[model samples]
Target chain A: MTAARTEDDLKTLMLLSLDGDEGAYRRLLHAARPLLVAYYGRRMSGAAQADVEDLVQDTLLSLHARRHTYDRTRPFTAWFFSIARYKLIDHHRGRGGRKAAETQLHDKIEDDFSAESLTARLDLDRLLDALPPAQREMIRQVRLEGRSVAETASSRGQSESAVKVSIHRGLKALAARIRGEA
Target chain B: MRKTDDIIESLVGDLKPVARHALSRRFLVAILSSLAVSLVLMLTLAGLRVDMAVALTLPVFWIKAAYNFLIAAIALFALYRIARPDGDTGPVFREIAVVVALMGVAAVFQLALSPEAVYRRLILGHSALHCPFLIFAFALPVLVAAFLWMRAAAPADLRQAGFMAGLAAGAAGAFVYSWFCTENGMPFVLIWYSLGILATGLLGLLLGPRLLRW
Candidate 1:
């Protein structure tokens, strides 16, 4: 099946599960496991199989607990991936991973060519528009424009620290927007 | 640890239809109930200001209440949004900033219009020393309620979510305290009330990572 068809099917199953359809819920969980494994496996390259499976289970549990947070108006895949990404981040933090590792993980997650990641990326520009102009410009320069913080700071005639703070706040706002959206 | 299949089976086994908008409902219930508790606490502890009748007739009283109420409303919405795994908090933060900024402008205007001698009185009301602590005390119930509800939901950024919850609770507390507070100066509210809210937010920021580990 096409990726679009798969996502639609998953969404239908999720809706049914939300309606208390146990069978659909079971199928949904089953279908999601492989995707979770693949997702974690790709990023956690050298990690043991057991560790990856553990992370998958953790994500599944979180999904179950946070089911009520799922908005019917949102694309299910986006919601699923967000939760998945959150769990992955939590896992890394739990293990006392360095900030660099977390940053790398973020990059890998964004680089993912999965249907959900693509959908989320498509929504990124719209989400950025919701930020204040200053924050939006900072994010565009530092993140989308891929300029160094020093360069962005000099160009904008702002302190480097100010530029960093703006970019941080903007990214945080973008994350919040995404979670609020899908 | 249990196998993944086992976990799935168990999750499905106890499946129940969750009410739609359950998160919002839970947050609303929490805020309302906690506000009620805070109101009762305020009335019993401090009682309404002696000149409540006169104060009610004054525009300043309503202005203070309205300001706190607006902050509470916006912060509560932000709290609710951030409790969700994918919820957005950016817009609410901007909105709250705007509300505070407007109050700041109001305070500046009030300060400008007042006599120079009353400047200290306007900025530092009789309760300035204790106002923030009192507000923080009153905010406890709501903050506790918010934290409890947040624990059940999946928040992406624990510190940010906690701060939002604290801001909402603190604003609610300030709104309740306004009934008993005799301070008529906008600067007092702008300073003391904001300090109270900020302190609570800081507390939340400090506790979020530890309490919201789930």
Candidate 2:
């Protein structure tokens, strides 16, 4: 999202870095950090936020070591994302055992960004499962489905304030569960 | 959080200039070394076929040699391309299919021209029992050497990369084995030699996820 770091700019930096420009290399890594974090976050919302950061760092380290393998002629995003994906798979394998990781990577990589959305949805479902039915339904309608409070309250034949309270309590419970404090 | 920036700052502080040669250059070095060693081993242990002089005069012998060498070259090219994470396999897969189809056409012509008993003879050639195993044996060292180069290249898809490596080695092994093999029949060359290459490919597939896991 940095103004100075477009994909073309990053590609130029990568090419310069390959040519031994230490400053360009550092800039490239710095610029890539947020992109990598967001890449992991979309897929890791079901897991700890810390694990997402760890994956980003792992990818950066790999990108550093394998910088030479980058082809100057190719688009940098494809190269970078592919490496990010491999690291994500390796991290999962390390955590959940090889079978799970292998299956996850095989299932995910075919449809591109669908994998991240799928994981986020799956994680959200797991998180929502921990809440009571009333609260879960409120959060699902208001927070997930983006339904208006009035629409939700009208559908359920409840007052607007009661629906608002349910949404609030549901979100708080979800956060506590995510924080492992519930 | 600025976690990535902190890591970057630390990495930059410790960064040193690291010179890297082009991957093609490195790949050439590894493959050439492997082929050279395989050739030397083949010559030393198996020696040339007894009919080397007569076989050299024939077109089929040369075609067999050319076929194996061409496959080897294609596999090597695929290996280099796939070693990069961003590389696509579509082109190489198409190229491979075309080559295999051409070889198949050539095999059909060969089968048609030969006499009835020739089919049996070609299938049960004198080296039929040992040909696949010999080529497989020759491919072992090449596989090891290719794997070493691939590890440093950091292939994202190890299964495909390893398969390419195996293929390259297998073709080289078949080429070398051609010099020692007296089975001039195309069927024998196609079947046994292919099986030999497939064996290496299978080995690669098995080792792919395990060895190439980064």
Interface RMSD of each: 1.8, 2.1
Give interface RMSD (Å), model 1.
1.8
Off by over 4 Å in 1: A1-5, A97-182
Native-to-model Cα distance after best TM-score fit, residue A129 in candidate 1, in Å = 36
Return the clash pairs for model 2, or none: none
Q: Give the alpha carbon lDDT tens digit for every residue of B36-154 in model 2.
A: 89989999999998889999998879988987888888888888888887675557767766767777777888889888878877666888888999998888778888998888887
Per-residue lDDT of candidate 2, residues A1-182 (tens digit): 43224456767878777776778878888778867776687677574777887788888888877766777777777788878887887787788897887788778654554434534544565577678988888887888768999999999999999999888888887778878854
Judge candidate 2 at residue B116 and give its lDDT.
Answer: 85
Quality of candidate 2 docking, DockQ: 0.34
Q: DockQ numbers for every candidate?
A: 0.41, 0.34
Chain B, per-candidate TM-score: 0.96, 0.91
Worst 10 residues of 2 chain B by lDDT: B12-21
| Alpha-carbon deviation at A92 in model 2, angstroms | 2.2
lDDT of model 2, residue A106? 75
